[model samples]
Target chain A: MFVRLSAALLAMAVLATAGSANAQSLTGSGKLLLTGGVSQIEGAAGGGLTPWAVIGGYGSARQIGANVYATDVNTTDFDIRSTGVLIGLYDRVELSYSRQAFNTQDVGTALGLGQNYTINQDTLGIKVKVLGDAVLDQDRWWPQVSVGAQFKKNDKAALVTALGARRGKDTDYYISATKLYLARGILLNGTLRSTRANQYGILGFGGMDDKRHTQFEGSAAWLINRKLAIGAEVRTKPDNLAIAKEGAAFDVFAAYAASKNISLTIAYADLGHVVTRRQTGLYASLQVGF
Target chain B: MTFIALALLLAAAPVPGQPGAATTPVIATDGKLFAEFGGREGLVKIVDDMFVNVDADPRINTFFEPAKREQTKARLVEQFCVVLGGGCTYTGKDMKAAHKNLGIQKADFNALVENLQKAMDKNGVPFSAQNKLLAALAPQHRDVVEKPAY
Candidate 1:
């Protein structure tokens, strides 16, 4: 899929330059912003199989100015995914929606239950820019800052109730703050996410008595050049469900912005599970906006 | 004996290299910076990229869409080249004189700057050189850009 997209993009680039006879004379301000990175604050959200930071935000391109993306997360026994889209209004405000699909393994065999289990959830988000430009304002001490929120809703009662869950469907809200500091050549981002969902269980885990989870995520990216970036992210996740005892995860990744239309990212992740295992993967995506 | 030795050592020095360092000639001039930026050819590429950027931008697209791209590009090239001390003559009005009525806002100026940066990056211009050019043009902001740029 990516190969075809790349071919198409290259073709367009060639066609754009083919008619050189009366080439347009130089005019206006000519600038292009490049965007691509490997990890999203250690797994906050990206293009990884599970949806990381790479695909979620209005990336660093100047043309489209704003964008939104969605994808699915597939694991061994079940499939989870998210779909969302965002629009950039006046290059300032962005509104988005993301739906999460939680597919549970067959209940009869895995949990001694009567039937198969599945769940669907949705999260609505909005992000607004409060400060500087991550690309053009290299001289300033301030970084471009944006504040956003996610309102999550879950659907699937029987299975959740059987698992001792509080409510079949509930709302989980979060406030995420992100910034890109260009002068330091480092993009520092942090988010405070407050949610009512259970650790690994999406349907308000631990019943109604469980306190909302407050997580802090931090990520830093070093810009190597206009086209490449390497970064790392550390984030805290809920472990209330006892699905895993891990408190945090860290990931290192490299990203390549092949052009205005294409971007690729790869990362090595450690969720710190039974024996401190390693999860390494690659992500490739194409974004087109006009 | 120490005073005599010190005097002899001081005298042995090469007379302070003719009492002062010779000044080097200024290799770069305002005109040269313009020429080095690919003269008119380079400016043309930048203009093309700028138009593409403006067209893609949703906020300012309406403002630029009505203008003929070719004419706009040609005028901009002449204006910028002349400002940078290039030999070409610009037919456009003075910066402040022309932009006073545009009601250009800060957001519009920022958007334009972003586009310019993109064009420079696409052309593979060194960051230092890009900044040098930008510094030379920074003074125009006072006149070419108006407050409340709608």
Candidate 2:
């Protein structure tokens, strides 16, 4: 599945660039550097793990921009690899898709499962900016707000059901507000999500029960310079999994926009209570955009 | 534990070889301080550079073309002088009155601001100094923007 998706994304990127004569000329001339956040875990334009209010890519108003990213997170007992593509339209709408493969390394054998068992999930997301511009409204009290939805489907449906999961597919809806304090060189984002997914659908959708709860995710970043940005994110989770206690997640990341076309991000993630115990790991991602 | 410590240390670490003592550039938030930096000459340079940028920016260039360039620049200088407490009273129209019918959108205002930033940069105004002036000018968005915030 990863191979197939990667092929499709690559093909689209080639096509978008090869036939780039018409709409490829982005003329809006957007704001300062690092204002457009990095891609999120689920392929949304945002922090590493959570979504922010800004759209993806460098395309300014009335322009189209595309981004491609591949991310890997290696933990004590697990390895998660995700790849995705995002498109930003007119700096108002965003569409993204990502495939995640959760490789339970030795932990699978320890849990009586086969060694290196993998759980895969596919996510499709769309977000629309409803109001405010984080960069333009720096002096005001208003913050940019956006609404988005993510549709996810897990591949290990039978195993997910056997583990007391609710279903194989579900959708999570969220509203986010992001603010960029240009003068202070700080960016803040807050989001409220209504979801039923367990372990972001890698462990399958929902938990033992049928109820969904609202979760909070927030991120803060400081633009140290035109090329460097450092941020921390915390995303709370719902405790629906009867199998294990699901705790909130935290990550501290540094992103370097090496150029307008490429950016690299490195982070230390503390994802609490996955499978059984805590998993702390290093995360690295590379994103290419036009 | 180690991650938190490392992040804190990175956050606290001084930015490598940049202007000002802090990671970001220094700015004079007050008129007296701004005067000490360069006063009228600095403001004039900033204004001149900003107009050059505005002239080049297609996003907001049309809005500026119909008006007399010199008169507008003079008014801006006067306004900036007063803003920085140069003791020059601005005799031009107030912000709301001056921009009432212009119907400036958030994007336009932001473009104008972007040009202003470039101008400040060209004149060697510290990032902090540019931000200070912008902070003082930010409130005028209420008068300049014809459209609602977005």
Highest lDDT, which number?
Answer: 2
RMSD versus native structure for model 1: 16.2
Expressed as tens digits, the lDDT of each residue in A93-163 for candidate 1 is: 55455555655555335655434455676556555554444444443333444455555556766666665
* Model 2: CA > 4 A from native: A1-28, A109-115, B1-29, B32-37, B51-70, B91-112, B136-150
lDDT of 1 by residue, B1-150 (tens): 223332443455344224222111122446666765677788889878887888888646765635566877888887667655666767866667766767665346556766776887887666555555554444354455453233
Q: For candidate 2, write residues A1-290 as lDDT tens digits.
A: 45765676666556655755664444343544566788899999999999998998776665567778899999878999989988887788988999899999888898877899899899999999866667765444667778899999999998887887879999998888898776677889988888888888887777767877788899999877668889999999887878777889999999999876889999999988888689999999999876
Give per-model TM-scores: 0.56, 0.79
Give DockQ per model, in order: 0.03, 0.13
Name the weakest run of 10 consecutive residues (lDDT summed) in model 2 chain B: B16-25
Candidate 1 wrongly placed segments (more than 4 Å) = A1-68, A74-78, A104-109, A112-117, A130-140, A199-209, A242-246, A254-290, B1-101, B105-150
